[model samples]
Target chain A: MKNNKNTVDPFENEPDFLAQFDKKTPFSVPDHYFESLPEVINDKILKKKSLKFGFDKMSYRILGPSAALIALFFVVFHFYNTPSGNTVQPEEFSDALLNEVSVELDDYMIYDVYAEIIEETESSTEQTSGNETENDEYIDYLLENDIDINTIIEEL
Target chain B: MEHYSDDQLLSMFAARESANYAFNLIVRKYQERLYWHIRRMVIDHDDADDVLQNTFIKAWKGLDNFKNESQLYTWLYRIATNETITFLNKKRKRFLISFHDVEGELTGSLEQDHHFSGKEIELKLQKAILTLPEKQRLVFNMKYYDDMKYEDMSQILNTSVGALKASYHHAVKKIEEYFKNH
Candidate 1:
């Protein structure tokens, strides 16, 4: 018997064996689809970053003007309400002088009380020192007037 | 003219003011391969299109960091695979479907889809593949469809070769059994 296995061609018998899968190619992608991808992506990233940077810069810029305006408004408002260049009238001057007089009177009262306390303390201290000095002078006179008691007793 | 490697092409694009030529070359080289890889995973043309664009965009942005340790195609494949998987995961999350149920639903959809060329056969095959656990399905796809060596697959997937072999064998047996039963 001739080898029947050798006679049979595996490929010949199954012409359409792999046909179902034949249509399936290595899934191909379209051409040049990603060529512009980098530019698109870079543009997006750069635009986003730039927008954020610009917004930050603009906010600081806006704040600079706003802060300056606020400061200027404050200064202008202060100066506008301020009494300057002989703006005080006679009545205002009189009212201010009255307030100054009251303040001076209060200061004078405080000084008067302080002076009285200081004078009283000084007089008391002087009296005490005078008495001490008198005692010292008497002691000195007694010492000078005293003869030698031992010599007198010996003579007796 | 000598064909430029992916790294070479990318460098040319980076250096040249008009990188369209080099970039176009990269697209031509990778598009078909990436499309099919994503198409098989996402199973929708529109989803595949979005993922493909995202993959290339990511590649373009990350090309500066690409060290050329692996082949450029492999690196792109990694990105494409990750994007497809991430898209599927997000879709599943949006749909509030369990991961297990997502596979079942995808299989059912494949079976009913008319857009697939070999609808019945491909659906049957896909359904059988869907029956596999996620890792096994990944292994089977890489091994059976992409014809990737286990060593390369291990490198791409960061799995042990032994583990991948077992997963592939299990997937193949399960699929063969499914075909037998059906």
Candidate 2:
């Protein structure tokens, strides 16, 4: 029996019975099975994707109100517990910290804070005037305060 | 009828627009080989089709995370192998049958299957193969029928080359013995 140099046939020395039998599969597929397989696979994939998307959309529809209710509960709890509040509210604390920061920095920094509060307003120092020193100072202040500028930006 | 290398296909898959197209090309390229591999194990065309569909669906979901640590075909073979085994196991569990019972059922199915057009000796050989322990049967089919090298078989089966060689050797002996008795 001919074999690739890399692959040795273990049945080479076996009886002729094994060697003589053709290794062709006995099974047959439906006509045009191979021709249509890719399209069938694509359809199944599309169907699965659409089903998953539908399920996700349904889940959001079902869970959206529940999430909003949970968030509302936290908000109500925060408002009522303010008198006894020992836990620092991240938003309020960050706001107060930034206000102090604006006072200590240039007047333009205050405009930066205001710009973030309303999306339409442009920051006075949008480019930081290409001022590397002031940029370094602003980043340093953020680091020292354990602040995430993105969190503050998103909240505003 | 263009043939693309695995690297080319994978890179095309990286782009959102061509991902589906690349995947289709991949399916067309490997479907026949994988289909036969699965069909041999399940011994039924419809069951093979279900298992094949499942194998590709799995490959689609997992392809992004495939690290290219192994050849693409080998990775796909591993999935097909695993999916076939899972399909068989599920069948046994669904019917509450033992391993030996399932083998008997598969052999019975083979007898009745209109698609099985094997000659007499080939049918006997297939029945003998079904008697093997599942892993040994896998080793024999890959070695005897597919002419798969031990290294590739080792990767696909996640077995040591020595172990696979030994398994194939034992499988051949058993099939020969089965022919003697029958």
Note the chain A TM-score of all models in turn.
0.25, 0.33
Query: Given candidate 2, what's the lDDT at residue B153?
Result: 95
All candidates: DockQ: 0.04, 0.35
TM-score of 1: 0.57
- Complex DockQ, candidate 1: 0.04
Q: How many backbone clashes does candidate 2 have?
A: 0
Give the CA lDDT, 0 to 100, for residue A137 in model 2: 66
lDDT of 1 by residue, A9-113 (tens): 442232232344544533334456456544554555457658879988987999789989999999999998877764543345335544654222233233333
| Model 2 lDDT, residue B178, Cα | 95
Error of 2 at A120 (Å): 67
| Per-residue C-alpha lDDT of model 2 across residues B49-135, encoded as one tens digit per residue | 999999999999999998879999999999999999999999999999998889899999899889888899888988999999999
lDDT of 2 by residue, A1-156 (tens): 775764865544444557878889877778899999899999999999999999899879977888899999999999887754444444454567667543233433433553334322324436444454555565566556655444554556
